[model samples]
Target: MNHLKFLLAIWKANLQSVMEYRVSFLTQVVGMMLNNFIYFAIWIVFFDRFKDVRGWGINDMYVTFGVLASAFGLVSLLFGNAFTLGDIINNGRLDYYLSLPRPVLLHAVSSRMISSGMGDFTYGFLSYAVSGPFTWDGLLRFVLAILLAAVVFAAFLILVNSLAFWMGIVSSFANLMLNAMITFGIYPITLFDNYAKLILFTVIPAALMGAVPAEYIRSASWQILAQLLLGAAILLGLAVTVFRSGLKRYESGSAIQVEV
Candidate 1:
């Protein structure tokens, strides 16, 4: 509970920091949404030319894109530091977090806010909205799906970023992993064979972040939701364990500074 409060406080601080530049923040958000929309236009062209790929249609892309973008947005917004953690670890900046009274991982990952994430988050709903045939229940289900997807994706980010602890500098690999998740995530799951599907569900876990959650959003299958829950728990547990283990070997930069 106390940790939750501390997390909230960090979020509040970051929000306030961005609030000081509301115009710029709004621009960043809107710009990202436009970027996302334009990027999806390529799929628009593909689907227009081909109609459908496998069992997935244009609407399926919309829904999947919505969940995947929102999941990415949540991480980018609330846990923005996840994207930069590799650099932090490599640069010895983690000393600041290590010296803090809060849980180091939580503190390290939640301390920044990427304003563009708000754009992604808002655009996700817009994408879902246009997908049509809406309901209160479906909206609620969408929320649940994105939350679970975000958990799985964030865990993956932390796990990859934590590699910096041993690799010295690995932000490129971390970015590649994240890009793979996004790249593989936006496509239809049926396009892959069983072996490739297994890799998506485990190695990259893009299926958990995209395919599974998107499936749940489109179908509301209890079975799919169960998969989401189990995957989230497992990935989160693994990421936390790996991060803690990495902490044991952390070599502080020892650049002393005071914190109030």
Candidate 2:
């Protein structure tokens, strides 16, 4: 109950901050939409050159990307400040969070909102809606997969941000991880060879977060379902462990300095 209230407070505060700069908020959303549209266009061009890649047609790829992209947009919107965790740690802003009664990780991240991500969310959802011959079962699977993927993705990002406790400058690494997940992880893992498949499905686990869940929606295989649940469990467990471990290393700071 207390956690729910804290989340509500964070939502209100974030909404107020976005409302303060209405023009900038809208512009940012527009810019993000254009950026995402360009990327999808490039993928379309690539498919035009090649008929199909690994038995997955261009349209199938579109649905997969759309689902994952929508889930990613949602994750970023609610947890946008996660990327700034490194900066917050470096500058001692984490001190304020540590002092708060609620979970510092949740409070620190939930306080900010990303209006730009709404554009991405809209684009992905529209793509998914348009490029579909989906049945009721397929739709249900897709929705469930997306929800589970969002949880795993959030856990992964939190795990990544926790790196700030040890390495003060982690922006480059975080950006690299995000890119790799989008580029290599978003595509169908079955297209890759055995070695590459192993890396994606295990080491990075982008396949589990995006591709595997997508496959389950498309084919409803029991194997795929099991993998999705297993991946979510592992990712969530790792995230919690990493976060708790990092918290112990945190040191609080105050702006008021004593002059020697």
Top candidate on lDDT is: 1
**Candidate 2 C-alpha lDDT tens digits along 1-260:** 99888888777778788869989988987888788878778778888998778787767776777777777777777777776777676677777777668898788777677888677677766666656785778777877887777777777777787798898778888888877777876576657998998888665778877777777877789887887888888888997788779888877557642211
Model 1 lDDT tens row, 135-241: 99999999999999999989999999998888888978998998999999998998999999999989899999888888898888999899899999999999999
Top candidate, metric TM-score: 1
Error of 2 at 231 (Å): 1.2
TM-score attained by model 1: 0.97
| Cα RMSD to the true fold for all candidates | 1.4, 3.4
- In model 2, residue pairs whose N, Cα or C atoms come closer than 3 Å (at least 3 residues apart or on different chains), thus clashing, are none
lDDT, candidates in the order shown: 0.91, 0.76
Off by over 4 Å in 1: 256-260
Task: Point out the worst 10-residue segment of candidate 2 by lDDT.
Answer: 251-260
